[model samples]
Target: MKQWLHLSAVAVFLTLLSVFPVLAQEEDEIDLSQIMKAAEKKSLSGGGFLEFQPSLIGLNRDSFFYQLNFGDQGPKRVGQYDFRVRLEGSYEKRTVGLYFTGDGLLRKGFQGWDSRARLFEGYLSLRLNPRFTLDAGKKTTKWGKGYAWNPVAFVDRPKDPEDLLEALEGFYVVSADITRSFQGPLKTLAFTPVLLPVLENLNSSFGKPGHLNFAGKVYFLLWNTDIDFLFLTGESRTTRFGFDFSRNLKSNLEIHAEWAWLTDLERIETSQDGRLSTTVSDEMSALVGLRYLTASETNFIAEYYHNGAGFGQRESEAIFEQAKSPSAVPGSRTGNSADAVFPPLLGIPNPMRDYLYFRTSQKEPFDILYFTPEFTSIFNLDDGSCQLIPGLTYSPQTNLLMRLRGIFLVGSEHTEFGEKQSNYRVEFRVRYFF
Candidate 1:
């Protein structure tokens, strides 16, 4: 009787062991299904980053722009601190979607404490089908094929050569995209049309006030090469036509180009005696570039740019000469006389006519992971001035990044880079993403 009882107990235990795994697996499947369904039904998602940047700026006290803007009395070197936060979110439901990206910045610099907030992008997108879509609100069109310079970016803001990949502020516009696929050398075609309005306190910086702008782009993928034809016209800005192309000659080598023609564009100049002058003429701007990647994880980029609308050698010299005059002093003239003459020279990046860009980056040297070092040089072919930047980026862990870089200017007196506010600058940046 005792032996029978023991055998029955062992059988009962074995039966429970077999049943438990099946029950647990079914429960796990149900939980996983719920989680996946919840994810699919989620209508809103968001992520952003926090950044801190500090810089040590080496002032060029004897420089033309420094003397004109800060006068003779200023620090030789100064420290600046910056804090930034970015918030981006997206909502999607069926054929409609909404997205927004906002940025806030606080800084303590030579001008003292300052803070500002901006909506980088906010738009509503309606996708009627895979081939047709519409977008309305502030957004970046991001046209052109050049990496460092985009003379053909008619509907977008200019790119900073030093930070070519950085996000830019957008213009409010209504736009549509129509796309089609083909089975030949011309594999794909797309058309984008944009309507941008410049009103008081709305997209006012885009151009003159009270005008609606029209722009369009036609894109084609012919023989595996990308090409685009673009145009913009309105009362706010002069009419312009643009063309851009990008092609890959090899798996590791790529080439790109951009060309723009503007009608009745304006160029401002200053005379030796502090007289301001303006010129209106037709202009053509262009850029050509190439990118190559080597087997050792090294990338090289080169570009040549011609700015037909930029200041000439004589014009730039005259402006620099005027900057040395007494009236160019910060408070020498009453009621902002200096504002009219200096804004053009100081505000625009690379205001000269001819330039060359060269850059190289090496990834993960010496078997180190998540590290990259880069060097960049921007040369002023007209003035013989140049700027050199060396930088390093490292990520020790996920969602965290650190970067350090230095910028040094090389030029003689009476040159474009020689008149910069800072001859050298070193900065460190840290970012955390969530």
Candidate 2:
């Protein structure tokens, strides 16, 4: 049954590829800054454009059990998920472009995730003046120059998305680049999302207002390099402040690093140890990495994320219990189980602050609840052009990532039985535009 479904998906994908040319124009050079002149042409007529992308992939993993007091532990099989699909697009515009994006999985079985969605991007902009412009709606507000979240490579876009979304919502922003003329391309944008009545859910069937989100950015460009420094604050107990720096090395080699301080917990409480904490342990996070693409489109990347694991009271009693009575509780967990691909390093500190051999992974698409039109500004996210997800992508220009993929979850080793409960996902998509 799974194989049949996969085949059906492939057939649908092929059909879309066969008609891309008829439905959308290929990438063309359009001077957005000069569009006002184009508008003056009496023969002007509006025409739209589009870009479609698709990909497939497979994954598998298993966990192992170990006892520190006893000795060496044995490996245990744990998780796995297979199947794929990721879609993204942009429509033609005389000035600023219109865009949106969605990416996730097409699961093969219960172990596989059914699907995940992301609003990615949606918004509109018109340069109101040379130094400023008004932007409204959903859009990505980026900041910083780091890997845990910065725009850099491809295998997947080398940036994070969750942090990006928190930075751009119901957007209204103004920007200025005093250095653009003398120091090359550099800009600074300062703005905040519109303030409206707060509601319970931003993502809902009825569509109600959510919490207030405010953010700002300073973008610097020099010799093909991009640096985005940001500040963001939002409701739902969220506050993301970080920096993302990415350097494009000759269009083939790329590198990046990131650092964020997230300490806006709504409440505080004592843990089982009776230790009341005012601050979330290591509210700070960091990552660093590099990427290189060969002539054949083959790519290579090595990245790392240190989530600073100083969550006080994280001193687990599992190993202690196992030593006293391994049978008292089989495969006990003192540290709670979650995906290991992006494990949290909550307490580690960097005295030297050197960003070598340590960085965060764009291990997964940061969110699972997102839906928006393909041409809206809320969906141009590609993981590459995001602030938090560190990813790498590759395309020979022929395939255009038709071979790319979505999230990398499902199978991974688990020392506990609870992890086996990784549930299946559901997917449904309805799309149209005016």
In order, how many clashes per candidate? 0, 63
* Whole-model lDDT per candidate: 0.88, 0.37
- Whole-structure CA lDDT of model 1: 0.88
Model 1, residue 159: displacement in angstroms?
Answer: 1.8
Q: State every prediction's TM-score relative to the real structure.
A: 0.89, 0.43
- Give RMSD (Å) of candidate 1 vs. truth: 4.9
Q: Once superposed on the true structure, which residue ranges of model 1 sit more than 4 Å away at CA?
A: 1-41, 269-276, 330-338
- Across residues 162-241, which tens digit of lDDT does each residue of candidate 2 receive? 22222222222232332233444543333333222235554232122465544555555655566555555555335556
- Mind giving the per-residue lDDT tens digits that candidate 1 earns over 1-434? 99999999999878876877666466554566877875775789998999999999998887766765677787899999999999999999999999999999999998899999999999999999989999999999999998788898888888887778778889999999999999989999999999999999889988999999999999999999999999999988999998999999999999999999999988876567656688799999999999999999799999999998898777777777665665555524333333466675656899889999999999999988999999999999988999999999999899999999999988877788887878999999999998
Shift of residue 333 alpha carbon in model 1, Å: 9.2
CA lDDT for candidate 2: 0.37
Candidate 2: 10-residue stretch with minimal lDDT: 375-384
Runs off by more than 4 Å, candidate 2: 1-108, 111-120, 127-133, 140-181, 184-198, 203-210, 222-225, 238-240, 248-254, 264-282, 292-299, 309-434
User: Candidate 1, residue 319: CA error in Å?
Assistant: 0.7
- Point to the candidate with the largest TM-score: 1
Clashing pairs for predicted structure model 1, backbone only: none
What TM-score, to 2 decimals, does candidate 1 have? 0.89
